[model samples]
Target: MGALSDVRVVDLTQVLAGPYCTMLLADMGADVVKVERPGGDLIRSSPPHLDDPEAEPYGGYFQSVNRGKRSIELDLGADDDRETFLELVETADVVVENYRVGTMESFDLAYETLAERNPELIYASIRGFGDPRTGETDRQGQPSFDIIAQALGGVMEITGAEDGPPMKVGPGIGDLFTATLNCIGILGALHHRERTGEGQYVDTAMYDSMLSMTERAIYLQSYQGSPPTRCGNAHPTLFPYNAFAVADGYVVVSAFGTNHWRALCDGIDRPDLADAYPRPADRLEHREEIHAELTEWMATHTTDDVVDRLEGSVPVAPVQDTDAIFGDPHVHEREMLYEVDQPGAGETVDIAGSAIKMSKTNPKPRGRAPLLDEHREELLAELAAQHEAISEK
Candidate 1:
């Protein structure tokens, strides 16, 4: 059993951010019941599926993030379904969702309504802007995805090559980061409830999350009176903290401190470079010359050779692809890849494992993502049992 084994979560989230947060809760041993609409989540049909879509239920996009949760379909628009949902909430420790503002209100299932049903319920929401219960904004009703948040929240402003256009990050940081923050808020609310026997609302916005992530740029702009722009693979302030092209592949080197810089110089057999650029400022001042010299040397050596020479002396790593990551012994040792049965895929496939590690009650995914409404009968039985137990009381 995990640390949160006793907690039950009513997950009314669809698509990426909301489902991802509930997935984390499930990993920590929460009994997460995913309350889907009649047709199910929008991303269930996202491509790259096996030959049999019906047996598989969903593609990799849905499977990757929605693991370890029970699914039940309910049409919130219907009165009977709404009553059933409220009953589920009455027994839940948490209620999480990621919908546009006023969505729950339309179904008459707002946070206020749910809190009335279960006073100790932690109501958490991940929105593009935020719910009005916390704060209202002009963009409250606007639907947004990862790219919109990245562009509006300053992540795109400082990404990409210096001369190139602003770019979205390779991964969906907007959704993922927002979801993680919302999870933290939910955990905090749970703690508060444990202390005071009172639950509260937790709100996280994707735009806000992206802005918080790009805090470095904000501080730099405040101090220098100008916003920093993209610098390709280089750090704006730190010299030799960038990716360099080796003969076979690219390797990143971080020689920020004086000792590491000296070690890098010695490892590369260029002690004179260390003598000339002894201080951090000196290295920053002559970064172009230093980069050119390092690049010239790296052009002759393979990524492995560079790593071998600087492994213990300086912070260095090859720019790894998925192939390298899959084959890495360290990754396997850390249990960062979790394998699960992929319905129609003929064999088990791997999803990312949980990063949270504890000495006792370690968190991990309980099982694969559920087929749509797979747990409907099971969940209904559970609700019936609860009703009987309450009647006896």
Candidate 2:
């Protein structure tokens, strides 16, 4: 048994955000039945598919995020399939979707409708702006991609190089972050339901999540009466908190205050520069000069050298990329990465593992993403049985 062993999720989400959230649920031992359209998710044909259409529809993009979930293909737009979905929803413990705000209502699968039949169902939604509740729906519209969310929600304006135009982070920060927040809300709602014997709605909008992610800047703008600026690798307020160049690699160092700065200077055998950072206002004024001095000190040192010298003196780490992430020794010790064998895709690539590590019921991805709706026949058979029984009743 895993953490969510008893959970059954009807996943009607596609692309990334909602799917990623369902993937987490699937990994934690929830029975996630992913319902895709007949032609399949837009991702199946997105890129990196089997040479023949008959073989597999699992695009590498889909494979990466959809792992551990079962798939069932249904043309939801068609008349016959609506009953199948409604049946699934009636029995489902949770129903999740990220369709456009009205799409589910258009399909008659909205929480208001489903909860009439499934009072205990935890109806969760992920959207671009927000549900009709938190505002921003009518004025701004229901559709927003990750970049759009980041742009409107306050990330794009403050991200990227100081000299460069505002840029999206390399990762799909808005999408993934929204998924994470949605997952949290789902868990919270589940907990509330479990305790009160009542199910409630959970909603997460990319806009709201992105705004929360940028709340500091929001605070700065509203209360401090100043807007945020692009700080490159450095933090908005923390001192000496940027990545620095090293001999063979780069390391990040953060000395938050005078005491840590003093310790860092002494550790480097250069007490002369201790608190040379001066007060916060002064250091903020002389940031370039201070950065230059620290860069000069670390210019000849390797990443490991700086780590060794500054181990306890300050917060420091090497600037590690993806490949480096897999190779890191700590990654091995913590078992933070997982590997699986693909039949012919060669060796299984190291992928990030479940952050939820339970002692009693630890769960993992059961299999690679299904080759399109490989389990369609099996899933439809079950739904078919339910359908016949409902008709007989």
Candidate 3:
């Protein structure tokens, strides 16, 4: 069994961050019961769906993060459904939600209410800003998404070509990072509960997570008295740590360290470079010259040629697209990709596997994402059985 096999989580989240957080817990064998509204999660109807009639009702967006969780429909606005959720909370170790600051209060199911019902319940929230209980802000209850967080978090400020407009990152780092932190918070709270037999609120804000992630930029600005700006793929503090275009494609080189720089010079058959720019600061001062020299040399070789020449000597990697990642032997051997049979689809699809590897109790997705309210009957029966057993006791 997984480490968290005995833990139960009531997942009252939709879309990305919250669901992804609970998915991490579920992967570790938490019994995550997703409490959906009457119509189900907004992402259930998201795009990139299969053409087959027998395919899973939802699309890739929903399937990717919601895997290994049980789903049950509940209209929290209704008194009966609210009471049902309370009953579920009393039996759960954790309850996670990502909604506006006051949304839960509207249903009279806020953390305060749930904590009263079950004093040992771990309640976590993933909000755009943060809940008022932990910290208050004027931006509380303001709607936000990945892009908004990216822009506000200073990520966009330092993310593009030096002279170009600010750009959003390729992936949803705003949501994903916040989710990971929130999961960490939940785990910490769980540990605290284990020690004290008490549960407390755990809160994570996307904006806050973004600010935390851009720590390097913050420190640079403070130390230099100048805010760092975008310089394409180059790092501000290191030289020869940028992507360059080869004949076939792009390859990133990270030969900023003294030994690695020497190795790079040797790999390129240019011992003079190491002698002329002995120190990393010297190389940084002559960044344009170094970039141009590398660019000229790179144009003569293919990505493979560059990688082959510098593979073991210097930190180098050819920029790989998703297709390359899918076919990579190292990726397969590491089990970074997982294939699961879609619930209703006759075909199997690949999803990203967990990165948390363990010697014992290795965590993995228990199964496919559930169909809407698919486990309603089974879950309600379980709850009813628990209630009956408690009454008997």
Candidate 4:
């Protein structure tokens, strides 16, 4: 059993942000009931399918985020299906969704209605701008995705090269970060409910999350009256703290401190540079010159050679790709990758494991993502039995 083994969640979410939130909850042992529309999640048709052509509906994109959850098909447009969803909600501890601003209200299944049916229901929503209950935005009804969030929230502005156009981060931090924050909000609401026997609506916006992620820029803009701009791989406040090109690929080196700078200079056989620039301010003043010298020195050595020379004294690492990560001993030692049986492909596939480690209540994926309506009959029977028991009382 995991930490949240007793909790049940009605997951009415699709795509990355909402499903990723419930994925974490499910990893922590919440009984996540994924309520999908008849056509199923759009990501199910996304690319990178397994070898088998006859496999089930979903591909890797869907499988990665929707794992270890029970799936039930429900069309809220239909009266009976809507009633069934409400019944499931009545028995659930939490209900989460990532629909448009007023979609739930249109279906007459908003948090207000769900909370009325189950007073202690923790209703959570993930939106692009956020729910009005928190703070209404001018863009409340406007649709958004990860790229939009990144561009509008100051993240793209401060990323990439100083000379290039604003760039979005490689991964969808906009969606993933919002999902993580929403999960935290849900956990906090759950704690409050445990104490007071009352639940509340919780939400996080992708744009808001991106703004929070770029907090340093916000403060700089406020204090210095200047917006932060991209500085390429170098940090705004630190020098000799950027990626350097080696013989084979690149390696990031950070010799920001005085001792580290001296060590780096000694390692690269440039003791004169260390003597000339002792302080960080001095180094920053001559950033271009020092960077050039370092670059020249680094180009002379391979990544492995540089690592061997500076591993203990300087913070340095080769820029690695997924293949390198897969073979890294540290990854295996930390249990960051898991191999799970995929029923559709009839083979085991590797998926990322949980980062949140615990001594006793270790959280993990319970199983693979469920087939469409796979648990519908079992769930209906369980709900019927629950209703009958309540009626008997």
Q: Best by TM-score, which number? A: 3
lDDT of 2: 0.81
Clashing pairs in 4: none
TM-score for all models, in order of appearance? 0.98, 0.90, 0.99, 0.98
What is candidate 4's lDDT per residue for 1-393, written digit by digit as tens? 899999999999999999999999999999999999998877888877787876875777888899999999999999999999999999899999999899999999989999999999999999999999999878998898999999999999999999999999998899999999999999999999999999999989999999999999999999999888999999988988999999999999999999999999998888999999999999999999999999999998999999999999999999999999999999999888877777756787878889999999998877788888889999999999999999999
> RMSD in Å for candidate 2, one decimal?
2.9
lDDT of 3 at 153: 93
lDDT against true structure, model 3:
0.93
Residues 164-267 of candidate 3: C-alpha lDDT, one tens digit per residue? 99999999999999999999999999999999999999999999999999999899989999989899999998999999998899999999999999999999
Question: Which residues of candidate 2, in runs, are more than 4 Å off?
Answer: 47-57, 133-136, 275-282, 341-347, 381-393
Ordered from best to worst TM-score, the candidate numbers read 3, 1, 4, 2
Tell me the deviation in Å of residue 115 in model 1.
Answer: 0.8
Off by over 4 Å in 4: none
Candidate 1 residue 129 C-alpha distance from true site, Å: 0.6
Model 3 scores worst on lDDT over the 10 consecutive residues at 339-348
Q: Tell me the deviation in Å of residue 239 in model 2.
A: 0.7
Candidate 4 has an lDDT of 0.93
For each candidate in the order shown, give its overall lDDT on alpha carbons.
0.92, 0.81, 0.93, 0.93
